[model samples]
Target: MNVKLKLPFVGEFGGTWAPQRAEAEAAWELYVELATRITYVELRPGEGLVREALTSVYSLFGTTRDILRRYGPAVSPADRAGELTFGTLALTVLNLSLRPMLARWHPRLLAWEDRRPDDVSKMDHENAWDQIGELRAKLEEARLGLVQLADVLAKVAGAAPLVVDPRLLSNPEKERGGG
Candidate 1:
């Protein structure tokens, strides 16, 4: 079926995942930071999606959104391909990195009076955001890179097909939607 999706994302420009390896890594970290730092486990209740988490994620989304807005249109696609790579990495981080941490933390917190995971507090000390000029620049550079990577993913997903299975929609039809 003709479909546009944010899923199975593969948006791009200037042919492929070029000129932005660092940025691409930054984009990946955005999802990682969101998954690992801001939230995880996907269920808790009122405090599960609490305000502090929302504020942190809001900052991240705003930063990334601004980056994408500035750089997205400049991408030129040499090939059209599904951006499943980004989606897959996101899923991997969610399951392998974030979920496992929560799994291990959940029971321990329960034993220790059933407190929620408060691990993120340590980041403030570790990052020491003010003193790390190099670190900050790296992050900014990564943000810029993510803009391009996200662009490729957005475009690719926009025209990509929606298929339940291989038999339902042939490979030829699926590839046709890409550049």
Candidate 2:
């Protein structure tokens, strides 16, 4: 399938270059921050940590989606390639880190009711577990979608040309070999 990748910006002299670069840099910083928090959550895995990690992940995902939306439909092939690559990497890491935690939590939460039948009825426990399981599955699916979008973003980021002075492009080629 022929996919037309959208460039972040297209104008004489790349009119939106500065703002776009700044936004991308900011997003990168946010991603790093969230990743760090997630690492901590992985190590700790307390109630507070789980809540924080989930909140941070959702926040980061929303921010990334917003940034991608701004690029519109003008992305070039190279740019799309770069964006997709980075995005997929990020999502892959997220899935690897989150899956085990979710799996562990699901069973623990389910078992809690069995141990305390009087405190929490089997039906209530089952209902809650089912709901949580459904939510987790949905979240997993969303994570996969984000990975796909990130893959596209990575492609776009990769394909973009590095910033160079106009004079450089116009200058004659120079040989590096010694005569």
Candidate 3:
């Protein structure tokens, strides 16, 4: 029997945020360690760890969002001038750092869900796997968005102006694009 394995999204873009990558890797390791312990519980065993991991992930996300919000706008005037503001770098690092944690947690969460008892008799295992696949796809998209934002931030880091239209920043569409 051939068993299909699901893989997490891994990016090749490096150096633009190396420190962030290290931090993110460490965070992901911790998350995995904690998650493994939690998942072993025969009956909701890792509830506390799960909550803690969720809280950490949410906090990281919030920090990233705040940094992006603060630095997304504002153009740099010249090549010598620094366009990549501290806020923008912070956002990039945080986003990059969270990649591993997000990747691991997503799979664990899906596995847990898979083990869960199906209330509706009509619900099928294949359907559950499909749902997990969908969730994984969404996660990948989110990660890609962060990477793209980081790429833009890297360009700004190289003396690009931080000038963004203030009105655009306020707009939901621009906000989604990291302005």
Best by TM-score: 2
Off by more than 4 A, model 3: 1-47, 71-85, 117-179
Q: Which ranking of candidates, highest TM-score first?
A: 2, 3, 1
In terms of lDDT, model 3 sits at 0.40
Error of 1 at 94 (Å): 18
State, as a TM-score between 0 and 1, how close model 3 is to the true structure: 0.30
Q: For residues 1-179, could you state the per-residue lDDT of candidate 3 as single tens digits?
A: 11111223434323332223333333333233323331222223212334333344456566445444543433211331343433433444445545665666666665765575666332343234444454444444443444344334434334232334345556776658955
> 1-179 in candidate 2: lDDT tens per residue?
11232221211111112124533444354344443443222222112322333455545546545544554333222555444333333334344544444555545554654554577754455445544454444444434443333333333344332223345664334443432
Flag regions of model 1 displaced more than 4 Å: 1-23, 46-49, 66-179
Model 3 superposed RMSD (Cα): 18.6
Which pairs in model 3 have colliding backbones? 24-97, 74-162, 74-163, 75-162, 75-163, 76-161, 76-162, 76-163
lDDT of 1 at 91: 38
Rank order by lDDT, top first? 3, 2, 1
Assess each prediction's global lDDT (C-alpha) against the native.
0.36, 0.40, 0.40
**114-148 per-residue lDDT for model 1 (tens digits):** 23246644334323333334323323333333333
Count of residue pairs whose backbone atoms collide, per candidate: 14, 32, 8
Error of 3 at 81 (Å): 7.1
